[model samples]
Target: MKTILFKSKLIRLFIAFLIFASCSKDDESSTVDIPTVNYTATNFDATFFQTGNSTAPTIDWNGDQGTFSLSAPLAGLNIDSINGILSWDKTLPIGIHNLQVIITNSAGQTVKNITLSNPLQGVFTGFIINGNSEHLEMEFFSDGTIIVKLEDSGSPPTAYGTWTKNNTTIIANLTNPENGVQASFSGTLTIDTTAKYTGNLYSNPNLTDPLGVFEVVLH
Candidate 1:
């Protein structure tokens, strides 16, 4: 009789254990509530500047990461759109000036602006070249134009070309129809207003090293 009672108690304990396991499994499989993600906006401006009303610059937000606006501005100024760039169409005064811009996107938002000034005016001298000494000098005008004459052999090159400056790079494209060929010289130009320059000239786009790096002082 005792053995039979012990077997019946064991069976009841197994059934109770199975019920508890089922309840724990149900709890593990239960669904959970999740929170929603918030939306935001932003803008991208690697370089920002303002020259005032005299010089109106074209700013490219490139759709600005998303939707946004420009908050900072000169006193008594307005923007064309809230989520894009603002330019000064009127001529700006000749001096350093600050500009402000704001932008936003689906993740967050941002405000940015920069101060810019006109390029420093440089004094220039007439052109000169000496190949024997490996020296070349040319005058660069503030109008973004240049007259460069360089030589390779013991004599100076009679060749002349025009050049222009964009940022720190200078491009000189010249064609010698008499020789039935065209060549381009490009490199970086270090310049200051007092007429000092450090020029690094390259023969091709794949510039291994500057063929000619020299200092030029304008008189």
Candidate 2:
């Protein structure tokens, strides 16, 4: 009886040892869960997935989003620092837009890219005079034309000229023979929804100078 009791105790200890060894092996081969982020956009979408061997990622919110129009604090663009999710509120423009996001994880820093396609093309109409007492107002045409209308001076002058827009700049030159004046004006124009240019003129020039900014919202 004594021998049997000793043998039984030895077998029980051996079984316990086997179980402990199995547990330790499993613990060493186990995998940890990594954080992942995702985002959705109507015009474009950007998704970011964390690596399995890395910890949380750090986000640097200071970066140029490669935008010429969507620039403002209240703009419809924002990024989540913790998750690296990018979102846009309103419609995108009609051109291609590329945005960059940098994520630093335990493994290393990873670069991400986002694309906003078919951005909402916008059109605006307005006039920029010399701001002097010439009273010279030229009409900007979508077909790249501008008509110079000299108030009621009765003298017809060179009222049409060529202009161009480089993303956000406007350059136009016109003459007011009725007022005996010729000048060129250039400035930054904004989308003025409060006013609209809807008058018929007597001249047409070939130039697509950006007058202002107006979005084409799909209602």
Clashes of each: 17, 8
lDDT, candidate 1, 152-186, per-residue tens: 45654433455655565656655443453344455
Please, what is the whole-model Cα lDDT of each candidate in the order they appear?
0.45, 0.42
* Per-model root-mean-square deviation over C-alphas: 17.1, 12.2
Weakest ten-residue segment in model 2 by summed lDDT = 46-55
Candidate 1 wrongly placed segments (more than 4 Å)? 1-132, 151-155, 160-162, 176-193, 205-210
Give per-residue CA lDDT, model 2, range 13-100, as digits (tens): 9999999999998876653222232334323531111111112233332321221111233234565556554555432222345666
